[model samples]
Target chain A: MIKISDLRKGIPISNDPYGDLAKIFSMRKDELIKILNDMVNKGQIIKFRALLDHEKLGYRVSALIAMNMDDENIEKVINLAHITHFYVREKNEKFPYSYFAMAHFFNEDELKSFSKKLDEMHINYEILRTVKNLKNDVK
Target chain B: MDEVDRKILIYIQNEFPIDDRPYLKIAKDLGLDEFEVMNRIINLYNLGYIKKIIPKLSKSYIEKYERALVAIKANEKDIVKVSEFINSFENITHNYLRDHHYNIWFTISGKNFEEILKQIKIITEKLEIDDYIILRSVKSLKLDTEFEVKK
Candidate 1:
């Protein structure tokens, strides 16, 4: 069972102190390190990442762009290591959408410049934006 | 680390007492001394379990806007350049290279459709990304579960 102690330890220590389990449990520094390492090895801890408010940072525009892989086999396409955290979904050319994807930018000109590159590469894509955010992790 | 602390977090997650002596009310609910409850809260913060104790702002109550999650397929040879290009924009919030084919993922918020399209154009050009995908969130669900695994 996932214990409250686990919750205490799962508090990501990267940013918030209150999220640190060692401090909450008063564990020794070494013990804290061991616990974190063990959790990571067990796949209970996936990643330590930061979530920022881009709109607050001046990113006024953003969109989702789905693409269709021209190649039948995704070997060469998959080999393109630049793409990260992408998944394969059912392909749909008629819908003008493929697997899910995302992008963010500061201005229209900046976004347009990127589109030109897509055209040159012959990559098909579309853009979607949130009409409203029902819930987001504020803390 | 104990049940009391767990209760404190659960309570705070749902609602934080708005009274002058919020800690006292919290203590009453947990059957603990006011000072002890305050100490536990402080310790939780120090330990890194509780990121923040802030007001829950209802997104619906605020000015409504659209959001999108963009994924990019950049050549690994140009990953750094692509990341730099994406990060250069202040509007591109929460960009990361996760382990996948579409490695570069980011969340973007815009005022309107035009603004969203504009960004898409700029990022693809700047990064020289050949292929990409967009996952539009038709329905969103969020769960607040602290992950902890003990043997």
Candidate 2:
């Protein structure tokens, strides 16, 4: 059993209580950790991170960049993503069909310039500018 | 069970209250005496549920940007120094070290993006650490206040 202090000290895999509807219930401590650990071992929870309000902090520029890569060379793209200071990897849910990536810049011109770099590589991609944020993907 | 008590917690989470009779208005809405309402909140706070009672500010009030999640492989020896240094930033609103590669996660709200970037650059240079990651949130869902009690 973890004390209230322990629970508060270490991060709970998630702050969203029902974020994973199937896994989280009214469990606590060992029971909850046991379930989370089991899921982790099974590769259910691949990554976890905190989500914060950047715009509230005055970050007005953000975009979702979709890049089409040769399926054979996807690993190269993923490696590049890890090193890029601003790019994050995600699955493309919509068109113009390709692997999805997202990043934020200081302004529209910066975003465009960044996209231009990908264009130079001849990577097929689409840039989706974020106008408003409504829901956070809490993981 | 009254609406006033429920709303008060919501208000507390979103922002601190800033009025002489913050409870008075709540009391009027609930059709209860002002002192009684105030006493009830005081009791709840004493029970260790809330950290404090303060005023809430609008989003526009915050003005800084750049943020990053830095994980360090330090032992108990340097944890205090690391936390103190990060917490010293006046702009840092939320700081927590979660269990991950980038264990140290902080939310910084400054007057502008440059101010936020300035803070991050200073930390990176001082710490001489480079395995940090910045997971900027793309969206923010309105947080709910429901607490889950374990049986």
- The residue-by-residue lDDT of candidate 2 on B77-127, one tens digit each, is 565677678777655555544443444555565545566667777986787
Docking class of 2: incorrect
DockQ of each: 0.03, 0.02
lDDT of 2 at A109: 75
Residues forming the 10-long window of minimal summed lDDT in candidate 2 chain B = B141-150
Cα deviation at B130, candidate 2, in Å, is 2.9
Candidate closest to the true structure, highest TM-score: 1
**Best lDDT among the predictions, by candidate number:** 1
lDDT of 2 by residue, A1-139 (tens): 3222222222322222223222334454445546544544554332222222334323467554446777664555444421122222223232224354446554567666766667766778765555433222222
| Quality class of the docking in candidate 1, CAPRI style | incorrect
Query: How many residue pairs clash in model 1?
Result: 46
Those runs of model 1 whose alpha carbons end farther than 4 Å from true positions after fitting are A1-139, B54-63, B75-96, B139-151
